[model samples]
Target: MDLDVFVTAHRAEWDRLEQLLGRGRRLTGAEADELVALYQRASTHLSLIQSSTPDAVLTGRLTQLVARARATVTGTRRAGWRDAARFFTSAFPAAVYLSRRWWIPTAVLSTLLGVLIGWWVAMNPEVQASIAAPEELRAMTEPGGGYEAYYSSHPAASFAAQVWTNNAQAAAVCLVAGAFLGLPVLWILFLNMANLGVGLGLMASAGRLDVFLGLILPHGLLELTAVFVAAGTGLRLGWTVIDPGPRTRRAALAEQGRAALGMAVGLAAVLFVSGLIEGFVTPSGLPTWARIAIGVAAEAVFLAYVYVLGGRAARAGEVGDVEAADRTASLPTAA
Candidate 1:
């Protein structure tokens, strides 16, 4: 039953029963006995109802009651982005961080992508040249390629915007496309890694590794983490179907799916945020020290926030302060 309805239905009868027992008021035989029982039942460590004025106690109880009513009324609304963040701040790290070793696979995927992309672009020079730049500068592919010339000729603002936009799109694809079982996620991960590998490989083969890493690594760390997380989530989903353990596939899928989505969302935000930094900040090929500093600082902040804050709120047995429980118990149920 709904909380307010339950409270309303029970409060009047309870109040009448209390009146007969004379709690918070003068009492004689039965009322005194009942009041004594109420006190004994509610004498928790934080029993604010016993400690605070009746008015303060009643007010707090009524506020909670009204709040529950309001929540019931606003069924259309759910928590917002902040709520999502709060959840990620707690859940992601708890699930992933106890074993920081989990990140090794992600790093390996990223490195492999780098290598493959380099090879692919090398093999498909024409496609590389085309995607990297248009025909007017096709010759830029010849000597260390035209990537440098392209960035040099383009305005800083424009380059940043393009890079940011591209990363944003890639991250989105990484997130959505990785939702299937392990294979799909693995493919997507490889596809992205290869793409990056080739793109950078083209640059590196052309002798632009310094420029590429400088521009990409700062934001790439977070952006790539987000992508790997997406892939991992997919693996999680696939595992559910493949190994369901003792639970039925359906049940395991639901439980793991919720967690995977949570991971996906966390990664999505990381991508977007990192994309912003990439597009505007590092894309300029900012000083080496500054880029490293920013990257390290960003990772640290993310790690600290995620692992530290989640699920610390009142858990089942330990939720309310003793006072809250005591106060709640004392309130007339019907009101």
Candidate 2:
């Protein structure tokens, strides 16, 4: 009960503990044992002071020291291959499946918008004229023209890397901007769809719609799906900010933010596949059907992974957040 006596008694042990901790990783075996013993004694000292005294300053210092000591004693766990494997197999897919409500609608609406715009541009000569001069349009959509040449402009490796970087950047933007109510995400999607429509219209007007489809479908299927997933997750994050349901707005945003992050990482891998297709398959001598089939097969596998592995993970109560043991304790609130 006597604070001064207690401090004097334990001060040397606390100082020794600090000294051992400061030794970095070169502690001798005896010192290691001594450090553990000192840590336990300091913990007991902290508990006694907390129970018997009202000294905020002393309590805070002990609290910090105890935490540091505990960490030093337990050591940190480095992420290993197993962690990465578990994430891809369980965490990433669950996040994708959980956001299916958002991404699926995004895919459907974007497709419809692109189709309508393409049709409008294709059917109207005036619209085509507005897009480009006759000479320029011809230079682009004509056989062996700019549209076809674009994919082969660079070496396959460089082009694939470029596509991957650009797509990853776009996905990252969608995720980071989700905090802004997903306005940027919507704008990005609109711009992408409009560009597609313009391309479709220009090619169709030139009677090269088949060629355009041939080149695009081989990569665009998976590429556009990844974009949709990114945009959808971003929109969902924004909605969480607006309507947090039963949880506090902060809690809801935190949860959605984590899921969005997981999608960002997973989408990078997905985009890589599409990048390979765009760089290689789109420009290859293979038959159009074969190229399109490759893209379709890749997309089918991704969807199945989400529905099967991710669906099961989600049903088992995984929302792609940190494990419960790692999460901070939340204060109790009325339902």
Candidate 3:
């Protein structure tokens, strides 16, 4: 098995493959057929050399050439509507259902924290003073003041767009920061809850707790749920780094990270709905019950989607990651 003789014999085939690949989508029918034939031959040649020889330079060059030829032959696939449909129906929900253990507790604890902090701020004058001057606080919570006006300050469409963008960015941060031991995710949740608490306390202190609930509940229900899902998924991702169980840490993180990203995109859509409710319904002339009812219905629909569709998908072994064919192969590692 003289490597020189093998190289001379296969050089022309390799050169032809390179030429076909470099043509950039203008191949004739005959050329395309030749490209496929060349790719198969190169693959066989690569396998033989890999098994029979140890020439690093030749092997590396052949490997790269084979990969390029293969790509040219198969081409890249563009995502279409079907991919989008599959994501929402299966991947997104499965991720939510799978991370229920993390996000559910996140929702509970964050709500409790906001309620407690709100109560404390309302009951204690010192806390109120620390948050803002009395006049400033009054200006914010007073009827026809900052709190109510904030929603209508901008046009409904603009407000909804702003809210969607902001919430999506926050969700992206949670998903990205999950790898940092989830500390940033927790911090983001805390900051959000703390702000909620302050708003609640200000409203309660001004004897406008009912108004606050009326305005917030309609959108907050679904809005906060999406945030909790993001945070919870992020925390779960971080924990994977700490305890990957039966899988290696890298594998676990990779899997959860992909799932977390899917959740981010899904949650963006959820937040968009919530944003619309906040922008239009909350500030509308509709009765309080009607507004809150709209919010509740949306939240209910989302929950059912997660529980029914997501549950079924997860049970069927969907983990919200990319399709198996798209995943990269990992090297064998000890468990």
Best by TM-score: 3
Q: Which portions of model 1 show Cα errors greater than 4 Å?
A: 1-85, 95-103, 116-179, 306-335
Candidate 1 clashes: the total is 14
Candidate 1 whole-model C-alpha lDDT, 0 to 1: 0.54
Candidate 2 local lDDT, 9-118, one digit each (tens): 88888888888887757788898899888877777777667546647888787767776777787676777898788789999999989989999999999999999999
Higher-ranked by lDDT: 1 or 2: 2
| TM-scores for candidates 1 onward, in order | 0.55, 0.80, 0.80
Q: Which of 1 and 3 is ahead in lDDT?
A: 3
lDDT of 1 by residue, 43-135 (tens): 221133333333455446544443333333233355578655545545555444432344457668568767766777766768666665655
Q: Distance (Å) between predicted and true CA of 61, model 3?
A: 7.7
Superposed on all Cα atoms, the candidates' RMSDs to the truth, in angstroms, are 12.1, 6.7, 5.7
Ranking by TM-score: 3, 2, 1
Q: Any residue pairs clashing in model 3, and if so which?
A: none
Q: Which candidate number maximizes lDDT?
A: 3
